[model samples]
Each structure stands twice: as C-alpha cells, then as structure tokens.
Target chain A: MTADVRDVWTYLADTPLLGLTATLIAWDAASWIWRRARMTPLLNPVLLAIVMIVIFLSATGIDYRRYFAGAQFIHFLLGPATVALAIPLYRQIHALRRSALAVTIALAFGSVTAAASAVGIAWALGASRSTILSLAPKSATTPIAMGIAKEIGGLPSLTAVLVLLTGIVGATMGPWLLAKLKVADPRAQGLALGVASHGIGTARALQSGEVAGAFSGLAMGLNGLATAILVPLLVRWLLN
Target chain B: MLSYITVLLGCQLAGETIVRLLGIPIPGPVVGMVVLFLLLAIRGGVPEGLDKVGRALLLNLSLLFVPAGVGVMVYLQRIAKEWLPISAALVIGTLITIAVTGLAMSALVKGRRQ
Candidate 1:
C-alpha cells in the first residue's frame, strides 16, 4: 500500500496539471474561508492561499520550480493584468485632474519614503546589503518591484517575496491605519493603499467603490514609475 | 477578447523595444501602461472590450501572485535568520507609508480648496 501510494504521488507530480489545479483550489478554499470569516484583514485570502499552497507543496515533496511550470500560466496573466491597470486609472480622470498636482507631488514623496524607509529601517536593524536592496522595492507590484530589485543589486526572488508580503500586509493593515488617521475620503484612502502597497492593496481598495479603486489604480501606476526611476539611483547612492 | 489582448501586447512589445533601445530601467508593461493611458486620454473613453477584460483582470489580480509568492519557501533559511529586520521593515515601513501618503493626500488636496 505504501509503495503504491508513493508511486501514485510520483506520477501525479510528474504531470503538468498539479500546479494549476492546486493554485486554483488553494485560492478558492482561501477565499471561501476568508469570506466566511467576514473578510477579516487578519485572514486575507492572498495570505491564506499562500500559506495553504506552501504547506501543500512541502508535504507533497513537490519542488517549487516544478510547481511553477504548471503555475506559470497564472503568472503569465500578470503581464496583461498589469496593462489592465490603466483602465481604472483612466476612469478616474476627472478626479485625477482636480488634484493632479497634489497627487503627483504625493506620488514622488510617498514613493521616496516607501523605498527609503524600508531600506533605512532594515539596514539600521542589521540586515545585509542584499536584504536592504530587496526591501527597497517592496511597494510596487511584483514584476516592477523585481525589475527594480535586480537593477539595484538585490535578489530579485527575494524582492518578489517581499513585494507580495508588502502588498498583503499593506492591504491588511492599510484600512485600519487610514481610519485611525481620520482619512475620510475613500479616494485618498485608495491613493494611500496603492502608493504604499500596489496590486493587492488596489484589490482591497476596489472593495470600497469605483472612486477609491480608480485612485488606487492611478496611484499604483504612478508609484511604479516613480520607484522604477528613482530607486536605482537611490540604491546606488546609498549603498556606495 | 483576443483583439483587446493584442492591443495590450502590442503596447507592451513596443514598450519593450523602447526600453531595450533606450536602456530605461522601468518595466516594459509599465511603459506600455503609460502608452495605453495616453491613448485612452486621446480617445476620451476606454474601449468596451478592453475595459471588460481589464476590469476582469483587476478583479482577480491577487489570484495571479500565488506562484511567485510560493517562492518564499526557497529562502526559508535566510528569512529565518533575518526575520526580525525583514518583519520589522515590512510591517513598520508599510504602516508609515500608509499614514504619510494618506495624510499628505488629504491635507494637500484640502489645502488647495482653502
């Protein structure tokens, strides 16, 4: 029985469908549970999904790289999904125009602060150079953040992980922080979420409404651009 | 859906070319996003097809990060050693950013009115 079970496991692992199926199932289960929990920030679906999948892979003795081969289909969608950000951003044009100057200035300021603070605090706390570099680009979406991390002498994989963690944590904690700060405007809250957390945060922002979603989308793009341009130079200057 | 996907891919392809030729540090899709944004601004409205696809993608955005997020396991050792700094930076850093950006946006926009 044990021998047969091992053989079956090996056979399943060799196929390409496991990663895709596992990801979908994990996300579904996570989402269902999170919703059942009343969408509590503590059990964010993304975070829950990640934890579930991580354990499944370890228990199954499946290599992550192998899992990625099947899962890359979902990952491939990130490209088009990223391009899609412009839609909501464009939807908010009128709102954007009213506070364009404020938004732009705040984008620059927040982008700088996001990167600088992550790097500064980590480094001061005794993280290695590579670790500091990885932390620097945590606010942007994974692809852009990973690109910036690679350009700035960081571990791109590490940056990818940090970016997700940042997004999950930001999305989870952001609303509470905003409420505490008396940020009454949904649009402003969305901007804060996007500038600070990227896609996952934007996902959370969208739950509030279109205006919030739009601002979050706009903030995501502008923050990505600002970090892409500024972090390389900033990392170079700071590390040297 | 196919045609709309093409528009996005076309922009991304063009953006990739520009980035390669110009040595720009930003990601190609982002530059493509800017191009798409400018084009939409000129058009004065989003095409229904693209909007449909894009919104669908946005609605399920977090679903796509699962694969990459799992890669965290690969660094278990490093993360374990540096857990303190990593956790502190991510948690504290994110809270600070949220507050600063939110307050700044609210104050600046309101200040403009007064």
Candidate 2:
C-alpha cells in the first residue's frame, strides 16, 4: 500500500497533467460553490480556485514550479485572451464612440484616484514602500498590476496576490455598493465594476445584460490604458 | 483557425516589440490589446478568425491564472507574517476605490446629461 502511494505521488510529480487536473478540479469546485450560493462575490471562483489549489499543493508537498511547468500552456494563452478583449469592445464601438470624452475623463480620474489612494492609505497605515507599490495598481488587471509592481520596486508575487484579492473584493461587493448608492443603470454599474475591479468585475457585469457587459468591457480596456500610462508617470513624479 | 492563431501571435509579437521600444511599464498583452483596438478602430471590424480566437480565449480565461495562483506558495511566509497588513490594505483600498470611482463616474455621467 505504501509503495503504491509513493508511485502515484511520483507519477503526479513527473507529469504536468497533474497540475492541469488540479486546476480543473479547483475551478469546478469554485463554480459549484458559486452556483449554490447564488453567485456571491465572496464565493468568487478565482479566489476559491486559488485557495483550493494552494491547499492541495501544500498538503501533497508539491512545489509550485513543477505545477506551473505543466501549466504553462494555459499561461501562454493569457496573451491571446487579453487581446481578445478588444473584440467585445469592438462590438460596442458605437457606444464607446459616443461616450469617448466621458470614458476618457472617467478613466483619467478613476485611474489616478485608484492608484493614489491605495499607496497613500497603505503608506499612512505604515506599510513598507514595496507594499505601497504593490497596492498602487491593484485596481488594474493582473498583468498590468504585476508590471506596475515590478517597475515601482514592489514584489511581483505580492502584487499578483493583491491583484487577485482586488478582483475578488470588487466582484463580491460591487453590486451591493452600486445598489446602495442607487446607481441602477446597467451601463453605469458595469462601467463602475470594470473600472474598479477589472476582469473579474466585468465577469460579474456580464450576468446583468449585454449592455452592461459592453460598458464593463469598455471600462476594463480604458482603465488598462489609463493606468498603464499614468501609474509609472505618477510614481516617477511622486518619488522624484 | 490557422489565421486566427497567426493574427494572435502577430499581435502579441507586435505588442511585445512596442512595449520594449517604448519602455512602457504595462504588459505585452495589454499593449497588444491597445494595438488590436486601434486596428479594429481603423478597419471598422474585427477580422473573422480573430473573433473566434478571442471568444475561445475568454471562455477559458480562469484557467490561465492557475500557474500564477500556484506561485502563491513562494510567498506563504510573507503572507502568513503580513496577513493583517495585507488584508487591511486590500479591504480598505478596495472600498475606497469602489466608492471614489463609482461616485466620480456617476457624477461625470450625470454632468454630461445636465
């Protein structure tokens, strides 16, 4: 019995498929929980999935590098997936065109406010400079947040965690926050969710309606651009 | 399908190139997204294969984060040690971001209406 168990462990460790299997299981478990809970944001699929994978790997004494080695195919697809966001944005081009000025201004103000308040509050609360940097771009999508973190001397790994947490929080509390403020328009809800939360919020917005999804998509794209330009420039200005 | 793969690869390459040349602090995919946006804006539509590839990619987006999520293992100690500070920052920062951005966007839209 012990020999069989050891063999199984060795097989899992040797093949990348074990990591992929873990990924699928975690995602499915998260989806099941979300469905049972009526799509509560706190039961966010990504957060739940990550928790599941972490617990599994830690328990089995498997290292992350081995898991990632088998899972690089999935990671490689993120590039295309991000680029695909433009298609939805393209479909909503007319609406985006009409709201060009509004989107631009909202993005500018929102991006600055998002980055500044995070760094300021973190610093005020006595976080290290690296922690402040990690938190600065938490509102943006994962990739951009990671880049900003690296540029400003934060730990990329920490920023990734912060990014995931930001998404989960935004997805979970976003609707409630909007409702409390009496912001009922789907477009407004979607845009707010996307700008503040990024892809995860947009996923939640998709459940509302196509219009909401469209606006959310627009917000996501514009926020990415706004933060991309403004975060580094602002950091440079502030630090210098 | 092949065409979609080509365009996807092409755009990704172009995006990486632009980022390196411009010294943009953003990721390559983000820059590719911007480039794709421009191309669509100029051409007035996404090429056919591009749409299919994009849809496929988006549907499976969650899976892509698996590797990164696993990387969390590397920071277990940091997270354990700094749980309070990290959680505080995330919770507080998210609330502020939601409140300020939500209000600011609502006001901006309302101002436009007025």
Candidate 3:
C-alpha cells in the first residue's frame, strides 16, 4: 500500500502533464459551473478557473512551475487567438466604419481615464507610488498593461492580476449595467466591453452578436494602442 | 475543411511575417487578425470554413488564459504584500473605465445626431 502511494506521488511530481491535466479539469469544471449559473459575470470562467487551479495545485502538492511547463501550449495560443479576433471585427466593418470617430474618441478618453483615475485613487488611499503605477494600466490589455506597469515602476505581476480582475469585472457587470441604463445600441455595448474588459470582454461581446463583437475588437485594439502611448507619457509627467 | 485550415494557417503565417518585417510591437495574433481581415475584405466575404474555425476558436477562448493565470503563482508574495493597492486599483479602475467609456460613447452617439 505504501509503495503504491509513493509511486503515484513520484509520478505526479515527475510528469509535467499533471499541470495541463489539472488546468483543463479545472477549466471544464468552472465552465460547467458558470454555464449552470447561466454565465453570470460574478462567476466568470477566468476567475473560477484560477481558483480551481490554485486549489488543485495546493492540494496535490504541485508547484506552479512544473504545472506551467505542460500548460504553456495553451498560453502560446493566446497570441494567435487574440489576432483571430479580427475576423469578427472585419465582418462588422461597415458598422465600425460608421462609428469610427466615436470609437477613436472613446478609446482616447477611456484609456486616459482608466490610467489616471487608478493612479489618483490609489494615491489618495495612501498606497505607495509603485502600487499606484502598477494600478495605472490595469484596464488595458495584458501586454500593454505590463509594459506600462514596468515603465512606471509598478510590479508587472501585480499589474497582471489587476488586468485579470478588470476583465472579470467588466465581463460580469457590463451587459447588465448597459441594459439597466437602457443602452440598446450594439455599438455602445461593444465599445464598453472592449475598453473596460479588454480581450475577455470582447470574447463575451462576440457571443452577443456580430456587431457587438466587431466594435469590441476595435475597442480592444484602439484601447491597447492608446494605453501604450498614454500610460508612459502620463507616468513620465507624474513622476517628473 | 482543408481550405479553411489552409487559410487559417496562412493568416497566422502572414500575421507573424508582417509583425516581424514591420517590427511592430503589437501582439502577433492581433497582427494575424489584421492580415486575415484584409484578405477577407479584398475577397468580399469570409470563406465558408473560416467561420466554423473562428467560432471554435472563440468559443474556447477562455481556455487559453488558463496558463497565464496560473503564472500568477510566481507573484504570490507580491500579491499578498500589495493586496490592498491591487484590489483598490482593479475596482476603482473598472468603475472609472465603465463610466468614461459609457459616457464618452453615449455622448459621441448623441453628438452625431446634432
């Protein structure tokens, strides 16, 4: 009995596949729950997946590095998947073209407000400068947010967390809030999802309809560019 | 099916090539998307299988984020030490984002009417 148990432990420890298995299992489980909950934003798949992965890792005595080795395949897909968002965006080109000015303005305003308010509010709350810097770019996509965070002296890892949380909160409350405010225009819905939630929210928007998906994609791209430019400049000005 | 796969792969390749050649800082996937869009636009419509593949890809989109989220473990200590700041930033940033975006979009739409 002892030998059998020891062999299982050794296998789990040595094999990188364990982590991938764990991640998929957790993701599927979370999906089931979220779907059962009828896709409530509060019970978002990303949030639930993270929770499940954490609990599974801890309980199984597996370290994250080992798990990540097997899971990087999925990670590698993120870049390509993000690029694929353009298909839906392209399909809605007519709608996007019509709202070009609106989207451009929204991205500019949304990107600036997202960074400034985060820094200002954090500073007011007595957080350290580094914390404020990291928080400044939370609403942008991960890569841009990380770059901004690093440039402004904030922790990239912490900024990553903030990014995920931002996505979740955006995906969760966005549609509900939009409906409540009687914002029926798909363009508006798409723009809100993209600017606030980034990629994940865009994914959610895609499910809503083609027009919403395209606008969200536009928001994702423009917001990313705006933050990439504005965040560094803002931080430079603030620090100086 | 084969044609769809070919186009998808071609788009991915073209995307990477453009990014590398142009030295663009944007994500490769985003670039790939741009190329795919241009191709579709020029052709005047998405090819049949493209939609199916795109749908499959988007549907399982959340799965792709799993690995990155797990990467968060490396920053466990940093997260704990800066929990307050992180949380404050996320919550407040979200509110500001929603408000600014919603208002700006609403105003833009409204302005167009006038």
Candidate 4:
C-alpha cells in the first residue's frame, strides 16, 4: 500500500496540472476565508495562499521547481497583468497631471528612502553586503526587484522572498499607518501603497476604490522604474 | 478577450525586444506597460474588452505571486540565520516608506491647493 501510494504521488506530481490546480485551489480557499473574515489586513489572501501552498508542498515532499512547473501558468499572467496596469494608470491621467510635481517629488523621496533606509538599517544591524543589496530593492515589484538584486550582487532568490515579504508587510501594515498619519486622499493613499508595497499593496488599494487603485497602479509602475535605475547606483556608492 | 490578450502579449513582446536590444535594466513587462499606456493615451480611451480583461487580470494579481512567494521555502535556513536584519529591514523599512510617501504626497498635493 505504501509503495503504491508513493508511485501515485510521483506520477501525479510530474503533471503540470496538479501544480496549477493546487495554486488555484489554495488561492480560492484563502480568498474565501479572507472575505469571511471581513477582509482584515492580517488575513491577506496572498500571504495565506502562500503559507498554505508551502505547507502543502512540504508535507507532500514536492520541491519548488516541480511546483513552479505547474504554477508557472499563473505566473505567466504577471506580464499581461502588469501591462494591464496601464489602463487604470491612463484613466487617472488628469489626476496624475494635476499632481505631477507632487507625484514626482514624492516618488523621488519615497524611492530613495525605501532603498536607503532598508540598506542602512540592514547594514547597521550587521547584515552582510549581499544581504544589504538584496534588501535595497525590496520595494520594487518582484520581477524587477529580483533583477535588481541579481545585478547588484545579491541573492536573487533571497531577494524574491524578501520582495514578497515586503509586499506583505506593506499590504498588512500600510492601512493602519496611513490612517494614523491622517492620509485621507485616495491619490496619496494609493501612491503610498504602491511605492512602498508594489503589486500586493496595489491589490489592497484597489479594494478601497477605483481612484485609489488607479493611482496605486501608477505608483507601482513608476517606482519599478525608479528603483531599477536607482538601486544599482546606490549600491555602488554605498558598498564602495 | 482573445484580442485584448493578444495586444497585451504583443506589447510585452515588443517590450522584451526593446529591452534586449537596448540592454536597459528595466523589466520587459514594465516597458510593455509603458507602451500600452502610450497606446491607450493615443487611442484616447480603454476599449470595453480591454478594460474587462485588464480588470480580470488585476483582480487576481495577488494570486500570481504565489509561485514566487513559495520560493521562500528554499531559503528557510538562510532566513532563520539572518532573521534579525531581514525582519527589521522589511517591516521597519516598509512602514517608514509608506508613512513618508503618504504624508509627503498628501501634504504636497494639499499645499499645491493653497
């Protein structure tokens, strides 16, 4: 019976369908719970889904690579989804223009602070150089963050995890912090979430309203651009 | 839906091509986003189908990151070893960024009004 079960597990694991199916099931289950819980920030669907999938993989003895083989289908949508961000961003064109200077200045300050503070705090706390580099791009979206990490002599995989954690942290803690700060403007709220948290934060911002979501998407894209250009230069100066 | 997907994929393809040719540091999808944004600006509005597809994609954006998030397992040992700096940087750094950006954007935009 044990041998038969092992054979079945191995056979099923090889198909891409299982990985894809597992990912969708996990996300749906997590989303359902998140809604049931009244959409608390602590119960972020992405975080919950990731935790569930991680546990499932570990218990089943499946490796990341094999799981990714199936999950890659969903992952592939990230590209198109990113492009889709342009629609919302474009819709907010008038608002974007009205606050162009504010957006530019705030984005500059926010982007610089994100990298500098992370790198500074990590280094001060005795993290190694590579780890510091990985932390520098944590605010960018995952793919760009991972790329920046690779270029700056950090562990790309470590950076990927760190990036995800940053998104989760931002999405979870961001609302409370904004509320505490009395940031009531949707544009400001969205920009903050996008700049600090990237896509996941934008996902949270969208739940608030379209105006917030559009700005969040805009901020996410702009920050990705800023961080990609800024971090490599910052790393050179800081590390050297 | 299919056409909208095609446009998105095409834009991404063009973005990848541009990045490859120019050897720029930006991600392909990001460039694609820019391209699509430009296209929409020229077109003067989002098509109904495009909006539907884009919203659908964005609606499930969080789900897309699950695969990459699970990659965290590969670095559990390293994370355990370096938990201090990692946790501090992510949590504190993220919160600080959010606070600064939110405050600055709000104040600046409000200041512009006056």
After the best TM-score superposition of candidate 4, give how far the Cα of residue B17 lies from its true spot, in angstroms: 1.6
* Each model's DockQ score: 0.68, 0.61, 0.43, 0.67
Q: Which ranges in model 1 have alpha carbons more than 4 Å from their true place?
A: A1-5, A175-187, A203-213
TM-score of each: 0.90, 0.90, 0.81, 0.89
- For model 2 the local lDDT of residue B95 reads 68
| Poorest lDDT segment (10 consecutive residues) of candidate 3 chain A | A77-86
Relative to the true structure, how large is the alpha-carbon lDDT of every model? 0.85, 0.77, 0.75, 0.87
lDDT of 2 by residue, A1-240 (tens): 999999998987879998878888888888899889987777777778888888888898888888887777777777777777778767776766877776677667677777887777777767766677777888887766776677677776677778878888888888888889887777678778888888888888999898778888788877876787788888778767
Per-residue lDDT of model 4, residues A203-235, tens digit only: 899998987887887898789879988998888
- lDDT of each residue in B10-95, candidate 2, tens digit only: 78789889889997777787788878888888898777777877888887776676667667778788777767667777777776
- The reply for model 3, stretches above 4 Å from the true place, is A119-137, A141-160, A171-186, A199-218, A225-240, B1-25
| DockQ of structure 3 | 0.43
i-RMS for every candidate (Å) is 2.0, 2.0, 3.3, 2.3
Quality of candidate 3's docking, in CAPRI categories? Answer: acceptable
Report model 2's interface C-alpha RMSD after superposition on the true interface residues.
2.0
True contacts kept of 3: 0.54
TM-score of chain B of each: 0.90, 0.92, 0.87, 0.92
What is the TM-score of candidate 1? Answer: 0.90
Q: For each candidate, how many residue pairs have backbone atoms clashing (under 3 Å)?
A: 0, 1, 3, 0
True contacts kept of each: 0.75, 0.57, 0.54, 0.82
